[model samples]
Target: MTVERRVGNEKIVELLEGVSRSQIIKQLRPVGDASSAQMNGGSDNVVASFKELIKRQDETIATLNHQIKNLTATWLHRKRFVKTLNEGIEAERELAKLKQEMAERCQIENDRKQAEQPHIEHFRSASLPAVAEQWQQYQIAQLPNAEEVVVQQLSAQVKQLEEQLTYGWQSFEVQGASLAQTSAQLVEANRKIHDLEVQLAAAMSNAATVEGARSQIRDELRKQALRMLDAMLRFLDFITLDAVACYTV
Candidate 1:
């Protein structure tokens, strides 16, 4: 009876131990499963975070490239505008020189006419004495031949003066036409310069606006990257703690 009672007590202790071990295993199973799920969830979160960061970085790079392209185009346009402005200014200077040359030519022509006037008067004075002598002879003799010779000489002198005046007037008309054409060209150049200036101003304004947008986008990207890094760090910390806890268990 004593041995049998001892055996029955041993069986009861074994059954109790088995029940406690099973209960512990049941509790540990859920914990292990939960830890495993957390690890998997953390891995997924990290991967997603990295992917999102990569996507944002790519977008930022693309934005920077776009901004660079815009800046380059603006710079090229400005260079072209500057070149055009320089060319216009040079053309204006050339026109001014042409006008100065025309003025000098007019002054020279006037001086030449002034120099010739004295000689013309001297010739008229010298010829008048001869003409007076002829006229006196014709009056004294009352001869038709003497009167005819004096009349022919006077008509020739008048014809020569009329020819000189006609040539001077024609030259003046030609010079006037050339000056008018140059004035019209200068006015057109000025109009084109004004248009180019307006275009440059508009381009500068557009560049400023684009730069502002690029800066704003860069700031947003920086903020987003920082947020992603912080979340990744926190996730890593959570995984580390979980690993340590599992090891302890």
Candidate 2:
């Protein structure tokens, strides 16, 4: 079903073929009269011995199949782990990019605010006081002996100037409130950026840990494969030695 299974099956077939070839060679070998007599008497015992070897070979194949399944499952799990880790890294990159963009926007906003500061200060420190002084002068000019129509017109002018002054103060208050809100927004953005940085740091730490674990897993898998190979080799040697002993007897 899988490449691993195919390879394992191929290996098992090769091992079986080699064993068959060895048996054929042994069968074809010429025997002395004494060996022939011994073989005739032990024919049943030889069949049982071969059956035991076949059983052991089957058991070895089953063990190998089990190990291969474990290897395949481990490989799949590692693949999923790496995919998740990559996704996390990509997300962190996007977050870093967003943080950079926000910082740039905040810098631009700060620059614009700085540029507008002079005009706002000029308006507050000079314009409002000048308007107040002009209004006081107009009020003083409204004397008891002034002409009726002229007094009425002057009263109307003073009232209009008072309205303008009130409107200007209101506009200044609104601007201050707007600036305060902008400052609050900037503070919130900065806090969010700091939080992102902290998360990025944690993600980096986790990535390092994952890397270490991956390396450890690789080493462990390599050791397991080596151990399996050694066991198989030893089993083959034992089978070969038993076959030789039977032939000699």
Which candidate wins on lDDT?
2
Which consecutive 10 residues in model 2 have the weakest lDDT in total?
A: 1-10
List TM-scores for all candidates, in order.
Answer: 0.36, 0.37
Expressed as tens digits, the lDDT of each residue in 1-249 for candidate 1 is: 011111245543643453445444554464565455654554465457556656766776777778888888999999999999999999999999999999999999999999999999999999999999888776756755766776877798788767766755565565457556555655665565565556555555686586665565556556655655565565556556545644453
TM match of model 1 to true structure: 0.36
* CA displacement after TM-score superposition, residue 31 of candidate 2 (Å): 23
Which RMSD values do the candidates have, in order? 49.3, 43.4
Worst 10 residues of 1 by lDDT: 1-10
Model 1: how far residue 28 lies from native, Å: 25
Local distance difference test, candidate 2 = 0.66
Which pairs, if any, clash in model 1? none
**70-143 per-residue lDDT for model 2 (tens digits):** 99899999999999999999999999999999999999999999999999998899988999988866866686
lDDT of 2 at 231: 51
Among these predictions, the greatest TM-score belongs to 2
TM-score of 2: 0.37
